[model samples]
Target: MKIDVKVPAVGESVTEATIGSWNKKNGEFVKRNEVLLLLETDKASVEVVAENDGVLAIQVEAGQVVKIGATVGILDTEGKASAVSSEAPKTAPVTASQPTQAPVTSSPASAHLSPAVQRIVTENNLNPSQIAGTGKDGRLTKGDVLAASTAAVAPTPAAAPAKTEAKSKAAPAPAIFAASGKLSKQGEKKIVPMTTIRKKIAERLVEAQNTAAILTTFNEIDMTKVNEIRNKYKDKFKEKYGISLGMMGIFTKAAVEALKAFPAVNAYISGAGAGTEIEYHNYYNIGIAVSTEKGLMVPVIKDADQMSLAEIEMAIRDYALKARDGKIGVDDLTGGTFSITNGGVFGSLMSTPILNPPQSAILGMHKVEDRAVVINGKIEVRPMMYVALSYDHRIIDGKESVSFLVKIKEGVEDPERLLFGV
Candidate 1:
C-alpha cells in the first residue's frame, strides 16, 4: 500500500505554501508521526509529519511552491528499508580505465544534508565531513557549505601548492568565490534568498500603507498605579495561576473596555465600490504582536473582553512561546478586531505603529521613564509611558481615536476600575 502525503490546509486564506526543507531524504525510512518536512506559509512554519512507517519518495523539492492538497510525496508501506552493506571495501577497486576517488565516511551531519546543501557540496568538490552543521539535528545547511567553500579559497603563501593538492584529492571543479571578489570577511557579504514568510510580510506592509488612510494619535500614561498593583499581587497571582502577571494583561483589559466605548476604533471598512460599509464586530478578538526569530507575528486572543487577567496573561505567554518556536499556526494569527504591539520590550521609547490591514487601529506601547509632573498643584515625579494609537482615518474619527486612548489611560491609571468592571 502507498500513502499519498498531501499538503495540509494551513488556514482559511492561505491556499499555498513553499517547501522550507525536507527532514528526510528520498528513500529514507520514516516512522509514524515523525516530521518529514517544513511548510512555510505567510503566517507560520508548519511541520508535515509521516502518517505511517514507510519509505519516503519525495516529489517536491525545497523552495518549490505547492498548493493546498497537492501531493508532495508518497509513502510505500510495503517496501522494505534498504539494508546497510557490511562487506569491507576492496583495497584496489578502481580499474585501469576508471578514476580513483577518496573514501567518504557517513556521519550524522553528512547523512542529513538538504537538497540545496548537497548540491553546493558536490559542485564545490568539498568534503561534507569537514563542514560543521548548525541546523537542527546536526544537519549540514547551505550556509555551512558556503562557509567551507569560502575558507577553502583563502589566499595564503602556500595557496599555489595547496591548490594543486586539492585538485589531486578530488575531481577537478571550478573554485566558488564570493560574488564581488576573492576571499573577503566571511560575514561581510553573502546573498541569501528571501523566505516565503518574509516576502509575504513585506507585501502586506506595503499594501497596508498604500490602501489605508492612516493617521496616528499619541498620549502618555502614568504607570505609578499599575506598577503598585502588580507589585502588590504579582507573587500571589503567579502562585495562583502558574504564570507571570505581565503588563500585557492590563493593557489588553484596558483596550477591550475602550473598544467597547469607542466601537469605531474596533471596526473596519468592508465590501467594494460605493456599496462598501463599515463592519462592526460585536465580539472582541485582540491580536498581540510578538517578535520572533523569523519575523513579527500577531496571534489573536479570542474573546479577550470576557477573559480574566490571569487567563489573558496565560494566553499571551503561550502565544509568545509558540511564535518564537515557529509552532504558531495561521488560525492563531487570524480574525482580530484590534492589535497591540509593545516596542518597549526592545527598548523603544516612542514609535508610530502601522495598522494591520482590515483592522482599523493598532496600539503602540513604549518604555516607562520617570518624569516630573504637576499633580495637586505641586511638582512630583511619576513613571510615565507614551502610547500611540494608529488608526484608519476613514473609519475612526479623530475624536473617537483620542477618546479611545483616554479610556485606556483611565483604566491603566486606576487599575481598580478593571477589577470592579467600571
Candidate 2:
C-alpha cells in the first residue's frame, strides 16, 4: 500500500499553497516523517512530510499550486532504500612506484547545499568548487550559485555585439535591469512567478492603501537614557534570560504604555459610516515585521502588554529564528493589534511604514546616529533615532496620534515611566 503525502492545513485563511521547493527527488527513497517538500501558503511556509518509509513519487513540481488536502506525492511502503550513498568508489592500490593521492570522494561543501541550490548548480553545469561561498563557514548558498552562473556567462552577451548593436543605442543601461535593481545582467532575462506569500503581501498592501486614510507622523527620539540602560543591563539581562536586550522590546513595552493611554491608536474602524464600529482592544498583540527570503512577515506577540521586557525580547527572537528557518506558522502571523518594523537594520535612516489592514497603526524605527542637539540650553552630541507612526486618520485623530507617539517617546527616554506604568 502507498501512503499519500498531502498538504496539511496551515491556517484558516490559507486556502491553497504553492510548492516552494522539493526536498526529495522523484522516485527517491525517503524515511517515515522525512520532509518531502516545502509548501508556501499566503501567510507562511509549511513542510510536507512522508507518512511511511518508502520511495517517493512526486505529483506536483516546484512553483505549482495545490489545494490544502491535495496529495503532492505518494510514498510506496514496499520500496526499500538503496545503498547508493554507502557505495564507495574503487581506487588503485597504493605502491612505492607511485605516490598516493588523496582519496576521491564527494565534496564536503556540497553536503551543506540545499536541494534547490544543488539543482541550480547541476543544471547550470557549474563547478561548486570554483564558486566562492558567502554563507556560514564558506558554504555556497543559492545566491552565491546564481552570482557565479551570471559571472560565467558575462562574456556571452559581449560576444554578440553585432546582434545587440541596434537595441543598445535605444535602450538605457538601466532598462535591462530587473525590478530587484540588479545591474548589468549579462544574459536574457527569465520571468519568474511570485510565491503565494508574496502575492498575499502585495494584495494586503494595496488593500491598505486603497481602503484606509493613511498618514505618517515623525518624531526624533533622544537615545541618551535608553543607551545608558542597554549599556548597563544588556550583559546582565542576557546572562539571566539568555537573550540580549534589544530596541524592539524596549519600544514594544513603551508602545504598550502609549497604547493604553490612547486606545484609538490600537483600535480599528470597521464597516461604512452608519454601521461602522470603532473596535477597541484591551489586550496588546504587537506584530514585529520580519524580512525573510520569502517576503515581509509580521509575527505577532500575543498579549504583549502583559509580557516583561525580557519576555518580549525572547518572543521576538524566537520569531526571527523561526522566520529564518522557514518554521514559522500561520498562527504566528495573524491577529495583531499594532505593528512595528525596523528599517534601521538595513541602514535605513527613516521610512514611512504602511498599516497592516484590520490594524489601525504601525511604528517605523530607523537608524540611530550621533547628532549634536541642545540639552538644557547646552549643545551636546547624543545618539538619536528617528521614529515614524503611520495610522488610519479615520479612527485616530492627529492629536491622538501625536500624543501616542509622545507617550512612547517619554516611556523609552525615561524607562522609569514604563516600570511604574505611567
Candidate 3:
C-alpha cells in the first residue's frame, strides 16, 4: 500500500509554505514517523514526517511553493529497509614490515547522522572521529558538528603576529571601493528567492509602517536590587529549579505587572471607522521574540500573568532551545497579547523594537552597564539597563506609554514589588 505524504495545515493564517530541504530522497527507505522534510511557513518551520515504513517517491522538489493538503511525495509501505551488516567493515591486512596506519574510510557516525547533520559535516570538512558525540547512543547531532568545526578551524593567537610580519614584508595592494567591486564582480552577481518567512516579515513590516502610528518611549532602570537578589539566591534557585535565574524572567514579570496597570497597552484594535473599538485582553500571553536562522519568531508564553517566576524562566529557556534546534511550531508562535525582545545578548545598548501586528505594544530590553548617577544627596555608580516601549500611538497615548514604562522600572528596581504585587 502507498500513502501520500501531504503538507499538513500549519495554521489558519498560513495558506501555503515553501518546501524546505528533504531529509530523505526518492527510493530511500524511511521508518514510520521519521522526519521526511521541512515546511517553511511565515510563522515557523514544520517538520513533515513519514506515515509508515516505506520507500519515498518525491514528486515536488524543494524550494517549491506548496499549499496545505498538497501532496509533496508518496510513501510505498510495501518497500523494506536494507539489512545492516552485523560484522564491522573489514580492513586490509597489514604486515609487520609496514608502518601501522589508520583507515581512511568515512566514520560510522554518518549512518546515525540526520540530513542537517550530514550537510554540516560535508560543508565544513570535519572529522567525525575527533568530535565526541553527545547525542543518544553516541550519535552525532548538528550542534556537535558545528562545535567541532569551530574548534578545529579556529586560528591560534600565536600565529597572528607571524602572519602580520609576513604581510608587512609583502608589497601593498591597491585599494578597491566596495561599490566598485559589487558592480564589477561577476561571481558576486547571484540571487536566491526569499523564503516564505522572510517574505511574510517584509510584507508585515511595510503594512505596519503604512497602517499604524508607531512611537517609542524610553526609560532606564537601576538594577542594584535585582542583581542583589539574583546574587543572594542564584545557587539555591538553580538547585531547586534546575535552571539558572535570569533577567528575562524578571523583566517578563515586570512587563506583566505594568500591562495590568495600563489596559490600553494590552488592547488590540478591531474593525474600521466607528465600528472600530479597542479589544482589551484580560489575560496576558507574553511573546518572547526569539531570533531564528530563517527570521525573527515570536513564540508566546500563554497566560504569562498566571505563571511563577521559575515557570517563566523555564518557558523562555524551552523556546530558546526550540529556536536553536529549528523545532518551533506555528501553534507556539500565535495568540500573543504583548511581546518583549532583548537585544542585550548581542551587546546592543539600545534599540526600538517594532510592534507585532494586532498586539498593541512591545518592550525592548538592552544591555546593562555601570553608570554614574546621583542618588539622593550623593553621586554613585550603579548597574543600569535601558528599556523601551514601542506602541501604537493611535491606541496608546504618550502618557500611557511613558507611565507603563515607569511601572516596569519600579517593578524591576524594587524586586519585591514584582513578587508581592505592590
Least well predicted 10-residue stretch by lDDT in candidate 3: 83-92
TM-score of 2: 0.82
Per residue, candidate 3 scores C-alpha lDDT tens digits across 1-422 of 98999999989988898877667656678898899987888888889998889988778866779999999888989976443211112323556533343322345554555535654554454556666788877778778897877776555676678768876887353243253333334343435577688888898888777777899999999999999999999999999999999999999999999999999999998888532788998999999998865678889999998999999999999998787667889889888999999999899999988889888899999999999999998999999899999999999999999999999999999888887887
lDDT by residue (1-422, candidate 1, tens digit) is: 99999999988888999887666667778899998888889888888999999988878876789999999999999887653211112223547543333445677788765434654664455668767788778877668898888876666564568667876887444445454535445545457677778888899889789889899999999999889988999999999999977899999999999998899988889988532798999999999999865678899999998899899999999999787656788889989999999999998999999999889999999999999999999999999999999999888889999999999999999988888767
Off by over 4 Å in 2: 81-132, 151-188, 272-275
Could you give the C-alpha RMSD of every candidate to the true structure, in order shown?
6.8, 8.2, 8.9
- Which has the greatest lDDT? 1
| Model 2: per-residue Cα lDDT at residue 397 | 93
Ranking of candidates on lDDT, top first: 1, 2, 3
Would you estimate the TM-scores of all the predictions?
A: 0.79, 0.82, 0.78
Better of 1 and 3 by lDDT: 1
Residues 1-422 of candidate 2: C-alpha lDDT, one tens digit per residue: 88888889888777898887767666678887788887788888887877778987777767678998998778889876554322112223556633333322345555555544654664554667667788777777879998977876665554577547756676554667766656665855797667678899999999999989999999999988998999999899999999988889999999999999999998878778532888899899999999876779999999998898888999999999888778788899888999999999999999999999889999999999999999999999999999999999989899999999999999888999999999
Report how far residue 166 has shifted in candidate 1, in Å.
Answer: 12
